[model samples]
Target chain A: MGLIQREIERAGIATIGISIVREFTEKVQPPRTVFLRWPFGHPLGEPGNSAQQRAVVLEALRALYQIEEPGTIIDLPFRWRREKYADYLPPTAADLE
Target chain B: MDVTRFKNRTLARLATRFPRLAQRFIDGYQAQESAGSIPWAVPKPLRQAKLALVTTSGIHHQRQAPFDMNDSDGDPSYRTLNGEELFDDFQITHDYYDHTDARKDPNIIFPLGPLRELVSEGLLGRLAQTHYAFMGHIDGRHIPTLVEKTAREVAAKLKADQVDLVLLTPA
Candidate 1:
């Protein structure tokens, strides 16, 4: 969350945040941000996909070094395979509300 | 009609329709009654002492556009809290109500008002000049990257200002 990162940063420690949605974070305006195009809840991917999750987390940690200024955003280059999971049903708008 | 039977029938129907919801309700209820009996990691005192609050409620200045609720379906990665000014006219637009409402109170989500109170009482060193917020249901791939980048930048500024602890409140 932007607030957690902000708090950590405010405490004189370095922080970074990865987000799936850009609009809300854009408002909070943390120093550095990365956007990924994936469904909600499972930020790193399916629960068992440790390999993919670790890779994504490592990439996010790496972004901290690349960003030098506040309000910088980058879109990661990754895609989720539809065939990877047959039970994958992303939440719908009605379900969310 | 027996009252016990009526209650049991109602609960059975509810569970059939929303099994996860029913489970969560039972879990939370039991957790509350048990109080501190469950084992979980207790957070250490923040070495970096500057404190901040985070909310998933997609709260923003009324002037700003709200987070895209339509983006993620059932398992929304992001969570929103209707706290601060953003919740003055807040509305739910997602199905994952448990995460969103787990600690639904505004004071719990956005503790700025209380932080200021602490400052007045000298309970804390000081509140960060600014706080942060986000939409909770973010996809994981993007979160690590975006959160890290923003945190690093914000940390630099906070360090420059001599802040020491950060209190993270996730909704």
Candidate 2:
């Protein structure tokens, strides 16, 4: 989607991406980007968790206004608590098969 | 371990073993679960709870317009999952949708089956009459209007049906 953002930017629309992974997105280097250390499937954060979603969304929206130069990336200060990661693990091949 | 080092090592391993699969898994997991649930000092009572699933799988009826792939490749906002029933013969088109290797399984993406299970178990209050799908790649150009329109229409329909939560599932 970063590519789309760049297109939009090329079309004269300012764009910002709220990416979970900084490394990959940094490579694309959109005009403005925000990296949050969040899990996949839930960009704005867990189902039914609106506040976090709103904050993340708002922050991304804010980046559109705050950043002046192209290719700006900012790492959000937020981190998930350790306990949350305890029961959570990426799926394995066995589960997929 | 420090967070940076931990994420770097984990991502590096995924990148080496399963680059495409790893991207999908990490994108899904990190986008939502990485930070845990965002805390709300005072959580608002859900205004509209009739739930639905929106994905980025570029799923659409063969007759409907396909999501713009070019847009998906560039902008994050152009991707949306179409909200149509899965065809019995439907097959995944992208390697990124692989969930089999995930520890939690890929049911997290299309939880419709699980949601049905939950419904049978009486875990949810009620299911919306319909769910939604959208490709994950969207460019955000004119998307605010589109999303608002979609959300409003969906919410209205779900509210009419008395749905209390919209479970957004990104594939």
Candidate 3:
């Protein structure tokens, strides 16, 4: 996945990837990434949990803009099965700008 | 006797259930070392940039050909996905991970559901009509094929579509 992201970013479109395994992301080093220490097949969090999923998507998009250095991987703070989505602060337009 | 498939599935289940076990598998598998300047492109603001999703969760339309599970090296090919129609009929075909949860709700791995919600809320500008999916688990001889051929092809497609940014997910 990181290899693919590299190719896409090389084509001049910004890219951000969500990585379940930190080691793999570290090795491949795509342009930008957000690492989740969660299980495989659940990068955005639990099934049917829209709030949790949205929180992740928001953070990943934020990473796409915030990361100035290539190959930077931001470690996300959300914990599996323990996060409170109600308190999760998404990036507002002002924040992103 | 599909011993290899059975073995891979068993390992997947075990790894999914046990993170410690998953770590061992991660340690054993090595990604090719990448050296050199990483790629870069200035991103447009979230509310104005055209975005797309790319995933390696082995997802595809129900009618598309399933990725090959017989090869241990894994499938290097990709499937074109239509964001507007994907959730209506989609399936996952990777054997390297237990996709039971993803099957229940693909947003966990694909996040198209959330991405659409963002577009509706105006946090994102728009989604490209086309997205992409790969089976991942590609290794050995197939890595070159993924990096050199299929991935670049998808990149070119994204470029042609004028996507400003892409969000990638992995299984």
- List, in order, the clash count of every candidate structure: 53, 63, 0
Candidate 1, residues A1-97, lDDT tens digits: the string is 5544554554545455666545545655655667765543334444445445444543543455555666677786667534333333432222211
Candidate 2 chain A has its poorest 10 consecutive residues by lDDT at: A88-97
- Candidate number with greatest lDDT: 3
TM-score of each: 0.39, 0.40, 0.98
Query: Ten consecutive residues with minimal summed lDDT in candidate 1 chain B?
Result: B30-39
Report the error of model 2 at residue A90, Å. Answer: 19
Output the worst ten-in-a-row residue range by lDDT, candidate 2 chain B: B35-44
Residue-level error in angstroms, candidate 2, position B149? 3.6
Which of candidates 1 and 3 is the stronger one according to DockQ? 3
CAPRI docking class of candidate 3 = high
- Report the candidate with higher DockQ, 2 versus 3: 3
Candidate fnat values, all: 0.07, 0.03, 0.92
Specify the highest-TM-score model's number: 3
lDDT of 2 at B153: 49
lDDT of each: 0.45, 0.42, 0.91
lDDT of 2 by residue, A16-41 (tens): 45665566565555456777665544
Off by over 4 Å in 1: A1-11, A14-97, B1-50, B73-95, B98-105
